[model samples]
Target: MAGTRRIVVIGAGGAGLAAALEAGRAGADVLLLEAAEQVGGATARAGGVVYASDTPVQKARGVQDSVDELINYYMTVSRHELEPRLLRASAEGTRQVIGWLEDLGITWNPDRLYIAGLEHKPRGHMPTGDTRGLGPAGGAMIVAALLTAVERADNVEIRTGTRCTSLLTGEDQVVVGVRTETGEEIPADAVILATGGFGAGTEMLRKYWPDAVRHGDWHWYLGPDTNIGDGVRMGLAAGGELRGRGGTLLETPNFGRLNDAFTPPWLIYVNKHGHRFVDETDTYCVMPHLIGRQPEGRCWAVFDDAALQKVADGGYVDPYGLGVDLESNWTAAMLRRQIEAGVVTSGATLAELAARTGIAAAGLEATAEQWNADVAGGRDTVFEKQGTLAPVSTAPFYAVELRPAIIGITFAGLRIDHEARVLDTAGRPIPGLFAGGEVVGGLDADVYAGGGTSIGNALVFGRTAARTATGGAA
Candidate 1:
C-alpha cells in the first residue's frame, strides 16, 4: 500500500480507458473518472478506424506501409506543423499499441480497408463485427472490451458522472490531483487529462477557436455532449499551454441535426446560387475544406428518387461517403425519416424543390440539366467528379441545406511534449501532469487527416502517458 502509486485518469473515453488499463495493469492504483453516466465518449460515436503504421493487419494483408511513409503523409497533410517528436512516437508505436489491443482480446476486421482522409494507403484498423448501424460499431466494441478489462482489474476504480472541475497543484505548480464539481478532491501521484476538445463549448469555441464559431449560428458539434473543453479549461487554469486551437474536422455542414448523418456520394452539393462546387467524390477532409471556402460556409445536397433508390437497392456509401458494398452509414430509411421530419424537403419538380429549399428555380434547373448531361456523357465537365456520375433527373427531388459543422473532435487543447507530459507556456513539462487524446493538441494543424488519426493518437499516447506516469517503460 505504501509503495503503490496513484494514477488519476479524467474522461473515460478511449484515451482514459486505455490509460487506466495500462496504469492499473502496471501495479498502480488507477482511478478512472467520467462526467457521463458511462464510458465511450466521442470514440463510441466515431467511425472506429485507428490509423496505425506497420500494424499486424497491414503485414498480413501486405499493405507495404512504413513509419517513414506515414510521417511523410502526416507532414504533407498537416503542412509540416505537427510536433516531430510526437509524430515519430505515434508512427513507431502505433503497431505496438494495436498489438496491445489485440493482446487484450480485441479482434480486428480484416475484410474492410478505410482510406478516407488518410493518404496513399489503407492504415485503418477496426474491430471485428463492429459495423452495425450509422454509428461506429468498432468504437463501441473497443470501449466494451476496455470496460471489461478495467472491471476485472483490482487496482482500477471507475467512477462515472464525476466531472473534474479543476486541477490541484502543489509547490512549484506541479499538479497533484483534481477537484470535482461537488468539491470532491481526488489526489493522485500523476494525472492524465484525456478529456476531449471544445466542440460543444460555444464560449470556448468563440474565445479560443473563433474560426470554428465564425459561421453564423449554423455551426454545430457532432461529438459527445461531454466534450465541452473540460480538460482544456482545467489545464489552462493549471497554466498548461494550448496548441492547434484554430481549426477542426468538419463536413458539408447541416441544418440543425438534419444532415448530421453521413454524406452520400450520389447526392449533389450546390451553393446558394445553385452551382456545384468541388468534386463530390473528393475525400472527406478535402470536402469540408472545399465547403468552407464557399460563401458563408454554405452548401446544399440535392438528390432525386433514383439516387435514393440506388441506396434502397443495396448500393452503399462507406463512412467517408465513398461508394461501397458495405452498409450505408446513412440509410434510405433514415432519409425517409428525415423527409417525414421535414428536415429534408421533397418536390415533384426541380422548380418545386428549389422553392422548398430556398434556392433560385432557374439556377437549380440549370444545375440539374448539366448534371444529367454529365451523367449521360460519363464525365463531369464542371468539377470532374470521380467515379460514375449519376443523373438526378428522377423525381421527387430532395434538398437539404448544409452549414459547416464539426463532425469530429475539435482541434485545440492543452499542449504536451513527446513523452505525453502537459507543457507550460514556457514549453516546460509540468511534473506529474500528463495528457493524451484530443486534449493534447499539436498532432494536427489546419487539416484533419481522418477518423483513424484521432483514435490512433488516443490509444498510442494514452498507453504512453500511463507508462510514463508509472515510471515504467514508455
Candidate 2:
C-alpha cells in the first residue's frame, strides 16, 4: 500500500465514478469520496443520453456519421469558444466512451435519435430504461450500471458522506491530496476533482455567475441539491483556472413540469406584457433564451378549458413529436393539484384571468382574440408556427406562470486540457492535478448543444484523467 500509486477522486457522480473505475481497473490505489449519502449526483437525475458519432450502433442502424462532421458541428455549437484539442478529443473519443460503457454492461436504447438542441444530426445514444418525466429515459440506469462496476472493482474504495473541503498541495503547487470536512487529511499521489457546479449556492452563484440571478432570484436547478461548487473551491484554492464562468443550461417551461423537452402546442405563451413571443413549439433551449430576455425571465402558458380537456384526454397533437408521449407523460390530476396550490390560476373571462394573473387586461383580451382568429384560420401568422393550431376559447381560462429551471449541466468551473489536466492562470497544468465532468467546464461555454453533451464530456474526460493519472494511455 505504501509503494502503490494512490489516486483520490472527489465526488461520486458520473465523472468521478468513471474515473475511479478506470483507475482501479488500471491497478492504481483508487479512493472515491462523496459528500452525500448517495453515489449518483446530478447524473442520476439526468436523461441518460450520451452523444457519440460513428459508433457500431450507427452502422447497425444504417446511420452514417463521422468524427469530422461531429467536430464541425460541435465547433459551430460552441461558437468556436471551445479549445480545439479538447473539442477534438471529445468528438473522437465519443465512440470509445460509448463502447466502454457497453463493456461495463450498460445497454443503450435501441433507437438512435437526433436531439433538437444539438443543432446537428442525430447521434444521441440513450441508455435503456424509463426516462425522466418528459424525455430521454434511464439516467438512473446508467448510474446503476456504473455503480455496479465500481463495486466489483477490487482496487476501488468508495466512501460516501465524506465531503472534501480542500485540496492538499505541495510547496511546488502540485496537488497531493484532499482535506475532508471532518478535518481528516488524506494524502495521495494524485487527485481528480469532479464535484459538479454551484447551482444550489446562491452566494457562489452571485459571486461567480451573477447574470443567472435576476432581481435576486436564481433560477431553480433540477440537479441534485448536493452540487454546491465544492470542487470549484478546492480547485481554485489550488491555483486551478476557471473556464466558461457564466454559462449554464437552463430549462424553464411556460407550463407544467413534464420534465421532458416537451412544450404543448395547444397553449400560447405570453410574457409579462401579455404578448406572445417565440414559436411556442421551439426547442427547450430556444424557448428559455426567449423567456429569459423578458422583463423578469418569466412567462405564462395561457389556455382554456377546451384545450385543457383535450390535454386531459391525452389527444393533443405534438407537431414536432419532440416532447413526451401525451398518454404517458403527465396527468390532469397533477394540474389539478397545482391549480389547488394557486400556481396555476384560472378565471371565467380573459379580463378576469388577467386580473388573477396580473397581466394587462386589454393586452390579454386582444392577444386571446387574435390567437383565436389565427387558430380558426389554421395559421400562426405572427410567429410562423407551422403546426396544428387551437384557440384559447371556452370559459375557465388558465395561466401557468413559469420560471427557468436547470438540471442538465452547469458550465462554470476549473479549466482542463485534452488530457484532463487542470490548469493554472499561466495556462500550465498543475502537476498531478486533473479534473473532469461538470467540475471542468469549457464544453458548454455559452449555449448548450444538447442533452448528452455533458454526460459525454464527463465519461470521456473522466477516463482520460484516470488513465493519465495512473500512467496509462490517455
Candidate 3:
C-alpha cells in the first residue's frame, strides 16, 4: 500500500506547526516532533507580531506602503549586510502569511497596527487571539491558532515528549528521517528542522556567540531550556553548513528574569565615565548594541527621586507594554525593594552618587547640568531623545548598573536558501532536507531588524519549507 508523501517536521514551535499544517493540508503525511512537554518554542513567548507591508491591515489603517519600501528600510537599518533576495522572500512571505493566518482564526486589528521597527512605517501586524494563559499573549495567540489548525488536519500526527538526537541518511547523502533518543527511527520522505536558536545551550554559546558569555554568570536565555541547538547539531552532522552571527540581547538590571526588554523613558543612561551614550528611550533592537559600545561594555541608568516617586505613583511603566504586560523592571516599587536591599546605589549629591557608583564625579555633575538645561529648554541637545524629559535635580540621586545580559534570540544556525531548503558547505541544497525559524541563519546582520522580524521569519520559512518539500502544494 502506497501512502501519501511522508514529511517529518522537527520542533513543534511556530515554524514546525506552520510546516506541519501546510504539509498536511497539501496532502502530505506530517510527523511533528517536539522535545518539550509543550509546543510553541520561543515563539510562544514572543510579543506575537508579524512584520509585513502593503497589506489589507495596513490599508485599513490608511497607511500606504510597498514591498520595495519595506525592503529598503530593512536594508538600510541592517546597513545592507543582509541578502537582498532573502529579505525579499521574508517581506513577501510575511505580508501573505498575515492573510493566511487570518483564514486560520487569527484577527488583525487596524488600531493595533503600529511601527515595530526602526523604520518610519507601520509594518508590525499584531494578531488578535487568545493564548488562554498558555504563554506570552501575542505570540501565544499565533501558536495556538497554528496548533489548532494542525490538530484538525487529518494527515498531521503530533508527537510530544520525543527528542530527536540525530538524522537518518540514505544513499547519495540524502536525509530520510530522524533518530530519537530512545533509538526509535521513523523514516520520512523529507525532514524540516524547526528546532530554535542555541541561546540556551552553554557550549554553543561559548563557541558560536561569545558576546553573550562576555557578561559571565549574569547571562541567561529567555527561550525554553529545550532550545539547545538540536536542529543545528543534527544539520551539521548531516552535512549542512552554518551561517550568520550575533543574537538579540536585552538590557536588564537582573530583575528576576521577567523578560523585560523595554525600559521606562524617565531615566537617562550613562557610561562608565558618567557620559550619556545613547538616547534613553531608544528601541531595544539598538539599545544593547549602543550600550555594548560604551566603556566597559556596560552602562548605568541614572534617575532622581522624582522619577522614582513617579514610579511609586503608578507611572513610568513601559508605555507600549511590550511582550504582553504593563509591568517592567523600571517600576518604582521594584526599585525601592532593590534600593532597600542595597542593589541600587544612592547618593545625596551628584559627586557623592558618582563616587558611590565609580563614575567620574566631574563628568557626572557636568552631564546632569546639561541634561537639566536641555529639559528646561524643551530640547535634547545631544541625542535628541524624544521621551518625556524629567530634570534629575531632585535630591537622593540614584544609579543602577544595567547590562545587556538577557539573551533573547540566537542568530547563528543552519544555512538555508530563500525557499527554506538547508544548504551544504558547497552551497548545494541537501535532498529531502529543509529548515525554518531561528534554525535558519543569514537572515539577520549586525543589528536586529525589529521586534516582530523573528516570529515573522519563523512562520514565513516554516510555510516555505513545507511548500517546497511538498512540491509547492503548501
Candidate 4:
C-alpha cells in the first residue's frame, strides 16, 4: 500500500471502466466513481460499434487497411481541426484494444465489419453474439463486458451515486484529490475525469453551442441526463482549458419522442426550399450537417399517398442491420393516423403541399417531376439515392417535418495531450490529472468523423490515461 499508486477515476463509463481495469491490472489501486446508481453512461446507450483499423478483424475479413489511412480520413472529415498526435494514439490504441477486448470475452466477428464512415474501407468492428440480457445489445454488451472485468479486478473498487463537486489542488496547482458534493474528499495519486459529453446541459449548450438549442422544444438529447458539463465545470475551475465544439445531432421528427434513428428509405428529405439535400441513405453522422446548411435549417420527409399506402406494418426501413427497433411511427396505420391527426401534413398537389409545408412551390414541383422521371427511368441522377425510388405521384402528397435536433454526443471539453494528461491554458500538462472520453476534446471538428469514434476514443484514451497515470508505458 505504501509503494502502490492510488488512482481515482470519476464517471464509470467506457473510459472510466477501461481506466480502472487497466490501472488495477497494473498493480495500482483504483477507485471508480459514478454519479448515477448504474455504472454505464452514454456508452451503454450507444450503437456499440468500435471504429479501428489495421486490426485482426479487418485482416481476417480480407480488408487491408492502415492506421495512417484512417487518420487521413479522420483529418479530412474534420478538416484537419483535430490534433495529429491524439489521432495517432487513438487510431493505434483502438487497433490493439480490439484484441484486448476480445481477450476479455468480447468477440469480434470478421464478418460483421462494415463501412461506418465516409471511407470506402471497412473499419467499424461490431461485437457478435447476444448481450446476455444486458439491456440492448451494442453498447450495453460492451459495457457489460468491461464491468464484469472490472468487478473481477481485486485492486479496483467501485462507488456509485457519488457526485464529485470540485478538485483539491496542493502546491504548484497539481490535483491532489476530488471533493464530493457531500464534503467528502478522496485523495489519490491521480484523478481521471471521464464524465462524458454535455448534451443534456442546456446552459452549457447555450454557452458552448447555441445552435444545439436553436429549436428549443424540438431539440432533445439521446444521452443520460447526468452528462451536464460537471467535468467541464470542474476542469475549468482547476485551470484546465476547453477545446473543440459542436457534436452529433441526429435528424428527428419528434413524433412521440421515439428513439428510432433511420427512416424508411423510400422517403425523400427536402430542405425548406423544396430541394433534396443529400443522399437519402447517408449515415447519420453528416446528415445533420447537410440539413443544417439548408435554408432555416428545416428539413422534411416527402412522400406520396402511394408510398404511404404500401408501407408495411412489421418493421421500418433499417438498412444498417443494427437491430435497433425501439419505436416506429412510419407504419401505414400510424401514417394514416398521423395524417388524420394533421401531424403529417398533406395536400392535393405539389403547390398545395409546398404552401402547407412552407416549401417553395416551384422547387417542390421541379423536384417531384424529376423524382418521377428518375423512378420511371430506374435511376436517380440527382442524389443517386440507393433506396427504393417511390414516385411522388398520387392524389395527395405528405410531408413530415424533420429537424436535426436530437443531440447525440458533444465534442467540447477539457484539453488533453496525446498521453491523456489534462492540459492548462498554457498547453502544459496538469500534474496528477488525466481525462478521457467526451470530457477531453480537440479530437473532432464540426462534423462527426465516424459512428464508433466516440466509444473507440473512450477505450483508447482511458487505457492510455491509466498507463500514464501509473508511470508505465502505453
Candidate 5:
C-alpha cells in the first residue's frame, strides 16, 4: 500500500471518473485517460438521475425500500439473466455507493419523483434545484459534479484527447497498461475499461443491435461520439465474453426531430401499422422492448390541438419537458411548421387525417368515438388509456412521424463477475483485468429498471473495481 500503485482508467465517462476518484481516494496513483476533447461520455447528455434503493433520500421520504427488494426488482426485471452474485453485490453496496458520492461532495436532491409507469417504490434521486450539472442546457449535472471531484483529487491525473487504441499486455497475457493512438504506452499496475458501448458505431450497432440500426432511428441521442466500443473490443480481444445481445431500446416520438434534435411534447405514439401499441405512459425501459416487438421496429407519435392542449396542461410531458421547448408552444404553430417543412401532414376532418396517415377512417372514427365515450364513461375499451382528460377529436388534426430514437445507452456489452472482472467463455474471470458500467453487458440484459440503472451501476461497479484492484475487501 505504501508503494506507488499505478492504476490507469480508460475513458473519462461516469464509470471511469468514478473508478479513478475511488482508487485515488484509496491512496492509489491514478491516471484517467479520455479520448475526446471533453470528459463525461453519455453522462454529459444524461438527465442526472440515479436509482438506488434505501438511500438517505428514500429514508427521509419514509419509503420502505430494502436491499432484498432492490435485488428482487433487478432479478425480476432482467428475468434472472444477470449473474446472481453481481446483482447481490450491487444491491448490498447501494448505500455505500451513495454514501461514497456524498463523501466526495456530490449532493443529491431530496425530492423523489416516480418513474412514469414502473411498479417499484420511489428510489430516483438527483441533484437539487435548477443547477443541471454539466453539458448542454443543464442536462449533465451528475457529470459536472463527478468531474469536479475527479479534478480535485490530488492522487488523480486526468488526460483528455488521448485515445487508448490497445491494451498493453505482459507475461501471462495480463493487462499492464494501454497503448495510445500516438503509440505511447502508459504503463500501469492495473487497468479498468469504461469506454461505454457501441451505440455510435454504425457497423457494430447494425451487426449486433440490428433492430435499432435497421430503422435508422437508434444512436440519435448521445454525448461522446468517440464511444465506439473500444473497451468492448479490447476486452474481447483479451479473452472476455460478451452477453445481452437482446436488450431494451427506447422508441419515443422524435418531437426533437422537428426542432433540430430538441425533444418535443404532445405527439401521439403509434406502432408501424399506424396503431397505438403499448401504454404511452410506460417507462422508457420497457417502451423500447414494446416498440421492438412491433412491425418494422418503428413507431409514430400523432399530435393535434387537443393533444397539444393536454401537453400544455402539464400531463405526460413532465419528464421530457426539461430537455425540450414544449410548453409555451402551440400545436397550430407546430402543424404549420411541419406542413411547410414536409415533415408532417394535416387535415380538417378526422377522415382526411386518417387518409393522410394511412389509418382506416372507419377504425379511426370508431377509436375516437370509443375513446371519447370512455372518457365520459370512466373506462377505456381499446387501449385502456386511463385518466384521459381530453380526446383526439378536434378539427385540423396534426400528425408528426416518429421512428425509434435510441439515446446512446445500449443495454448490451461484456459479461463480468462481482469483482468487476470480465468473464471468459467458460464463465471464469479474466485475470488482472476489470470492466464496469456499459462494458459489463449482462447487468441489465432482458430488461432495465426505469429510473437510473445505467448511472447507478456505473458508479457501483466502478468503486467495486477500485477496491478489487487495490487488493482490498470489496
Candidate 6:
C-alpha cells in the first residue's frame, strides 16, 4: 500500500493479460508468469466474440442495446444467482473494456446478428476479417493484440514457461507473491490468479465431482493441457471459497469433421436412446445444460449424404474443400472401431440402428418420421427447432457417438466481492488477493447467455480488480 506498487499476475490467458495490461497502465510494476510456452489459455482457442452492451461497435451498427437491458438479460438467464452488484459492474464497465481494446489497436466488426435462444438485443462484437491464417482458433488475433499492448507498456515483464507453484504468505496472512517451479520467489504487493478451469484436469474432475467421470469418453478436445485448476487450488489453499454448484457440461460432435479441429455446425446429435435431443443450432452456452438432462450425459451426431450435401451448400463444411469427405470421415471401418470400443453403434435401417444403439425402435422411427414430416411441413412440433432446411431421410444413416466434453473455464470457482477480492468462508474479502475470469465463479449459475458472457465478464472484472488493487476508481 505504498510507493510504486508491485503486482504479480499468474497465467498468461485472456484474463491474466487483461489484468496485467491494466495494472501496468496504472503504473504498477507487473510480472506476468505463464506455465506454458505460449500465452492465451482457452482464450486463444475461443471464437473471438466479446459480448459488450452499448459498445461503439453496437452503436456503429445502429443496434439498440443498453446496460439496463443487458443487466435484465443476465438476471433472466442467471436466474438471480448472480450478484446484482457484480452484474451491474460487468454491464457498466463492458463499454470501457471495449473502448480500451480499441485504444490498444484491436479492431471489432460492427455486425449485429441474433442467436435464437438468448434474450438480449444484438450486441455481440467479433474481431474483423478471417483470422484463420493466424492459428487454429481466432483467439490468436486477440492475444496478439493484447500482448502487443503489453509489450509497449512500461514496467511489465512477461515470463513464459514459468509455473507458479504456490502462494507466498506473509506473517499477516496476506499473499505476498508466488513461488515458481524454479524455486524462485517473486515478490509483489498484490497477486492475481487467472489460470482458468479444470477442463483438461481429468484427475481433478474425478476427485471433486465423480459424477462427471461418466462423460469422460468425450474429452477429445483437450483445451490447454496446463490448465489443471492450479489457480483454484492455490486460492482454496489461501482460504477462498468456491461458488456456483450444479453447472452444466457439453458434448460436441467428434472433431473428425473439421479436419480434426473443433469446428461447429453439427449435422445432428442423438442420445444413447438413438433420439435427437436438442436443437443442433442452439447457443453453445445452453447446449451443455440441455446435454446434462439426457441419459449418461452423452449424445451422437447422425448425418447422411443429403444432410452432408446441405452442409456443403451452406458453407458449414470446410470452405477450402479439403477433399476430406464425411463418408471417408465416418467410414464403416471407423464406425466398426467405435462400435467395438462401445463408443458408437451403426445399422442400415432406422429400426436396426435403433436396436443396435439400444433405443426404442418404434419411438426412434416415429421421431424420424415426425422429423421428416416436420421438414416437409416446414415446422417442428416438439423442440420447435428452427433452421430445418435439410431432412434426415437418407439411407445408410451414420451415427458418431459422443460424450460431454467439459471445456476448461469452469462455471464454478472462488467467490469474490464487488472489488474483485476473494471472499473468505465467512463472506469477507481477503486483502491483497484479487481474482477474475473463470477463477471467480457465480457468473453462470442457473442461466447462461451466449453473446459474450465469458469474455465480457473477464475484461470487466480484470479492469475492476486492477482498479481495486491499485486504489484507482473502478
Q: Please list all clashing residue pairs in model 2, or write none if there are none.
A: 131-137, 134-260
Task: Tell me the deviation in Å of residue 98 in model 3.
Answer: 1.1
- Candidate 3 stretches with Cα past 4 Å from truth are 1-3, 312-327
lDDT of 6 by residue, 1-474 (tens): 359999888888778888999999898999999899988877776655677788777888778778998888888887787899888888888777787777766777665334423764766666543332434444556677788888898789999999888899997678888999889998888998888776667776776545455644545333578877788889988888988753444454453432222223335666766577777766656776676778876666766546644443322333112222223333335445555675655568878777776666776777677777877888767667665445668866656655555453466788887778888888987778898777778777654566456777777787778777877887
- The digit string of per-residue lDDT tens for model 3 on 1-474 reads 176899999999899999999999889989999999999899988878898998999999899999999899889987887789889999999999999999989999888887787888888888888786668568889999999888888888999999999999999999999999999999999999999999889999999999887888788988899999999999999999998898889888876675665666679999878899888877778988899999888699999998888765462343443434555677777889889988889999999999999999888888999999999999999988876788899989999999999999998999888889999999999999999999988898878888889999999999999999999933
lDDT tens digits, residue span 17-96, model 4: 99999999999999999998888889888778999999999999899899999899989998888889989999999999
* N/CA/C clash count, model 4: 0
Tens-digit lDDT track for model 1 on 1-474? 899999999998889999999999899999999998878887766656778877778778777889988888889988888887888988987878777778777766555655646486778776653322424456766777677789999999999988889998999998999999999888999999999777888888888777776766657776678889899999888899889856554554343353233455587888877888877666655667778787766788888888777676442444533222344324687677678888888999989988877788888899999989988988888977666467989999998876556546677888888789999999999899999898888888877776578888898888889999999988
lDDT of 3 at 382: 95
Clashing pairs in 1: 253-403, 254-403
* C-alpha root-mean-square deviation, candidate 1: 3.6
Local accuracy of candidate 2 as per-residue lDDT tens digits, 41-104? 8787776778888888777777888988888887887778888889889988778988888886
C-alpha RMSD by candidate, in order = 3.6, 3.9, 1.8, 1.6, 3.5, 4.2
Instruction: Give per-residue lDDT, candidate 4, residue 336.
Output: 82
Best by lDDT: 3
Candidates 3 and 6, the one with greater TM-score: 3
Please, what is the TM-score per model? 0.88, 0.88, 0.96, 0.96, 0.89, 0.87
Encode model 5's per-residue lDDT on 249-284: one tens digit a residue: 555334442212223422445653456676565566
Candidate 2 residues lying further than 4 Å off, grouped into runs, are 1-3, 110-112, 118-120, 129-137, 215-219, 247-261, 313-330, 355-389, 405-408
Candidate 1, superposed: residue stretches over 4 Å from native: 129-136, 213-220, 246-261, 309-366, 379-388
| Candidate 2 worst ten-residue window by lDDT | 320-329
